[model samples]
Target: DAARQARYSFLWESAERMSCNRLATGHHRDDQAETVLMRLLCGSTLLGLGGIRPVDDSGRLIRPLLELSRKELEAFARCNHIPYAEDSSNLSEKYLRNRLRHKLIPEIERKYDPAFTRNLILLGEEAAFFRQCLEDRFRQLRDSLVEWAEGDSPRINCPAAAELPLVLRRYLLRRIVFDYTAGGVILSGRVLDAVDRLLVRGTSGRRLDLPGGLVACREFDFLSIGEKKSAPTGAQPEQIEIKGPGKTTIILGGLRWELSFEVRPYEAGTNNVFFQKEGAEGVWEERFDRDKLKFPLYAGAWRAGERIQPFGLEGTKKLKKLFLEKRIPCSMRMRIPVLRDSRGEVLWVCGVARSALGALSPESTSVLLVRALCLPVRGFTGVTIIDT
Candidate 1:
């Protein structure tokens, strides 16, 4: 296989160097039949059963003899006195393709069905047509259901995508995976089934590792598919000081952290860290009391033996314990930013909880709202926002 690929590469390079538009090969009907049979034996899908195409749409290669049988081509060559050398490898039974071509195909034609080859050709053509139809349908549905995010991953709207027919769902997911991976990986039937199951029934924060360093993650409302790499790394933990009402961006733990502080009127719907007694009403954002906070506010990565008095909890608990209870992957524990006071006391475990020191109270006149937004790197997406 390596040698074959090298030869093809050489041919393609030679064509390009010569300013040639196409490199033609002598693949015929028999080759197509063998390809179809091999794919079927290997439990291929309809797309795989489509067999060999006559012309590669990329315009780099063509097989003009695909419609002609090998026997006919040999007869024509002999009649025209056009001598050609037979490849010795063609007779070898060591390769699966050679075995099918030299032995199995002939045996089937002799003993069972003389029309087997013709039927295989017809099946390939039908499969190719059906594959094209499926691809077109997939594209139509994809445009409506899949949203390509700014990063390398693409997000599929679970509600709308789940409503698609089962076959279409599978095809659409396959298309998304292929496009994100740039066709470098082909998902197997089992993997596709697993992904479909996740799409249909998986809860938020669920993840599945796919081949070729890719991962499929389920957020609250969408499924994000992209390459899986380790979370970003950073130097030794450093405290980022925040004085007052302002916005600052910090690079820590391999992520871009955007922290904004403001004293805004507490609205019922907005996620405002309130200093007033009302506390937080929204689930997506965290609320902290401005008056209770100690400056300068420091932001750093989680450390060993760190504990936080998570709001509404009985007492202080280990940060590691909280992470375990939440099922946050270990790889992401450090990447989660931890906000602290000047004394190194944990305040708000960003996206996790706020320490008791900063709890909102009715006596407070103004509420300080601190918002932390963590942006993922190139291959990652679905930034988590923790609210307690």
Candidate 2:
């Protein structure tokens, strides 16, 4: 198994380095029969029982001779004067495949059906067809079921997902994990069972540690799934300074945000700032009373206990409270930029809330139009604003 893994890794790496589009292997019908038998003996789903795919899920790896028998290949080689060397390890019973090929398979073939291996191959083909049908169905339902955020982290609407039949729920969850891990962990039943419990009866704030460092946390309305993230020791969160009447671009947590600062006459009923939508997205573009703000603002991660007197609100509100009210999952709150003025007062909490400090007024002229475009990163459509 280790050797097979290493060989496959090398092949993938080599193909990428060489800029090759497709990778082909020498796996044959006998290998498929052996794999099916092994999977059945060890317990596997119909997808696993499909054995070696002629074309991998990515459609890059191909087994051209997957349906050809070993005997047929050898006969063709002999007749055409084509020489091929066999692996010496195949004769060793130390390996399970070798044991199956030499002892178990021969015994079964001699004592029972003469076409036992062929029957297994046939079973694998049928299973492969079944697996393809499942994949097609999954593709159709994946988007509405799974919401991918933070570039790769996948979450779901718990109540909506829970309403699905158990089989579909399992399939959806399995595909999500498979895509995130890039098929690293295989044939894992552990995550399926644990997450099912989480969805069915687990209360909000409850969670299960899934395989591959993946975590599933049940929120009030969302089942957030993401890998464990360890903060670096002795590393401080970098605070980027935004000093400009021009555009400044920044990358944070695998996302790109463009912040623009322009001092222009505030035109009534016309806000040039755009973030792909209205309502909450308007927060990304705020026309602040420029005369009120101190220059050279700093943008950083949200600090604990930070409060802001949000525009149109009477008093101050905690950043945490605002986030909860906005229904922004806790996992994303920290990554959201918290913009502050030079005096260290909160000016805007990025896409969440804006301070009433520099809010535009009817009498205010030459407004500071702060526009932010979130760039539709990783399927996350956050506010790209014109105001603050």
Candidate 3:
């Protein structure tokens, strides 16, 4: 009903009719701060700590008063002799925000500094700036360390991300899985920590179901984040030819990805890493002598009718069956990427597995290191992968 009302209101007041992009509202900082405090008390997610969004997704419904205080607004109204309707119902104790405003805030101002409201407003502004800086840092780290697959999900190289500073890691992790539910059931701190641990250290095939139907999965050395996907959507996973030993690019959902390769000594087993999205703990450099690696590693989307000897599983299994067993549906199966070598042997399946054949061993003369990178796109689209 609210959505329907909003839609009607938008259509009635649309730019075509009113010459305005949106109908703006005045929601003061006290209102926003009250919201944050209430949500925190009620157990909102980490991202909720920042309070309401300044700009909503649709580019309309902007909060122009995010930086204003009720007192200042009232003062402005008085100074300008701006007549406005005052709801006497505001004195009612039925609403918490109203109660806080009428009862608590005034008392706080008297008991504390006379400039309490002004100071709080300034504090909120400063906090917003700090949040921007944190978000900026997180984006910078995300650009270098994380990859969004075809869907609006995120993939992080556990080992590489773990090496980042704790703050950036947490911010990235929280932002990747952020939900805009102000009054819905949210994931608990325990579940978030469990997901983090699963990414940073747990074995592959582990999964966590968060609120809003979101799912977190641990595969190979990357953490996959997204809605509970059903089947692989696009072209079936197929063998793609990589001209070996050089960078390559692939495009999905308007995002470009790059794949690069190098040679070095190999480890006995998977250097399978899961780094938390917080704190600089996962960053590290492993190397192999250049002479030890095989040339011309292959990389591309997983094709239909492909199979893999998934980690500990016995014998070979169809990739489709594996995804089914893992509860991955058809939609997601479409986007899972696959990497291979010249002989058509699969090497790495994005967020899934690195073939035993490609597993680095101590005796390996050269190690083939594949680096996956995502090229930038215009806006907030979902995840995409590229390997070079």
Candidate 4:
């Protein structure tokens, strides 16, 4: 209605009312040329090169003569014997496009060949084609190795992704992290190189915090994407052990800890309660029937391919599976220690599950209690543990 009023005020009162499917404009290739130059000088990114698009989300605006040249449009009007009034105001040098069209561009055409207009159009067509090709390459890169998980960071299998051509690889990595952060930002080239460096070197546990609250963590020998939080920052993995009647403290990944042993009556659910505490959540202690058990039983760090039957479950489960089911984020899974006996039997998955083998029994009389906690590691420098 406002458009109708404006045109009517200018004696275009006889003009048809603007409809959703129909819009009236006189823009032509000259206008396109002006827009290209303007945006090139003022735009922030290269995607702006496509010039005006075919479809406008707002249905009221339409370009009926986008493909028409000024000479062709004038010829069409003459052939149809159409009578249309020209706005006298357009003759003035008030608008930038008008000034470029009337003065600057005409001067360029005069100084050079009069065929500059044709050359500019050809150049624009080439640029548009190049833009499309780049977009297609980016799309292929996106489809190859990108994946998203609910309420979590995107995961790109870095080893597989690293094999892509560097141009596409860099684009895809930026796109993954950008989408991971909801398009809020892009990672610096230095940060992307840092992650690529880790992947190329086969570094499994390396990570870097990127712009826009994004964390690019390496997992499964790949890159896993996630968000940074305000508190309880992401924690790293550690393997610390407590010996029978021995106390020891070690710092891993910036978290602090001390493990000490205490001997007491073996009672069902007694020591289990202590293991559930802060210091004991990752700690494991067990009491075996001395007469029925072997004295050479062992307790220490986990060896690879370890499996254990969790408490209350009859069958054995992979220690790795236990970590996954517990919703332990990828970064902490490797470093969490597993406790096993001398016969390659797992007694507990620290901070996670207690195996059925050494689980407390109702008639148990003697027991060993183990505790794991996050404490301030004293006098130990150069430990960086971030808990996510």
Best by lDDT: 1
Of candidate 2, the 10-residue stretch with the lowest lDDT total is 273-282
Clashes of each: 5, 9, 53, 19
For model 4 the local lDDT of residue 323 reads 60
Whole-model lDDT, model 3: 0.61
In model 1, pairs of residues that clash are 273-287, 273-288, 277-361, 277-362, 351-386
Better of 1 and 3 by lDDT: 1
Candidate 1 structure quality by residue, lDDT tens digits, 193-293: 99998888988778999999888888656888876867646555666888777888876546676777777554444433432211222112355666677
lDDT per residue for candidate 2 within 1-388, as digits (tens), equals 6998998899989999999999999899999999999999887877779888888768888899987889999999999999899889898989888888888998999999899999999999999888778778889887887777665677787888888777677777888777888886442776687888787778777878877787789876778778877765655567778776888876666556778899998767654233345542323666687888878887777777889988777989998888767776666666677778888788887766788888776777778887766655666666322232
lDDT of 1 at 195: 92
- Worst lDDT run of 10 residues, candidate 1, spans 275-284
RMSD of each: 5.9, 6.0, 12.1, 13.4
Per-residue lDDT over 102-166 for candidate 3, one digit per residue giving the tens place of the 0 to 100 score: 77668878897677655545545565677789888876777677775553456778898778766
Best-first order by lDDT: 1, 2, 3, 4
1-388 per-residue lDDT for model 4 (tens digits): 4854786355433334432344556678877777676656564234445565444546645677768888788888999998777778668898666787788779989997697766666656666676677668877766566655435446786777777776556667776776666668886667767767665664555677777677777665457777764554345233443335566665443344555555567655654423333332233334443223333444444444678877766788876676656655555554455555657577665566776665556766766665545453332221122221
Off by over 4 Å in 3: 1-16, 29-72, 75-81, 150-153, 178-190, 229-388
* TM-score, model 2 to reference: 0.66
Q: Give me the displacement of residue 82 in model 4, in angstroms.
A: 6.5
Better of 1 and 2 by lDDT: 1
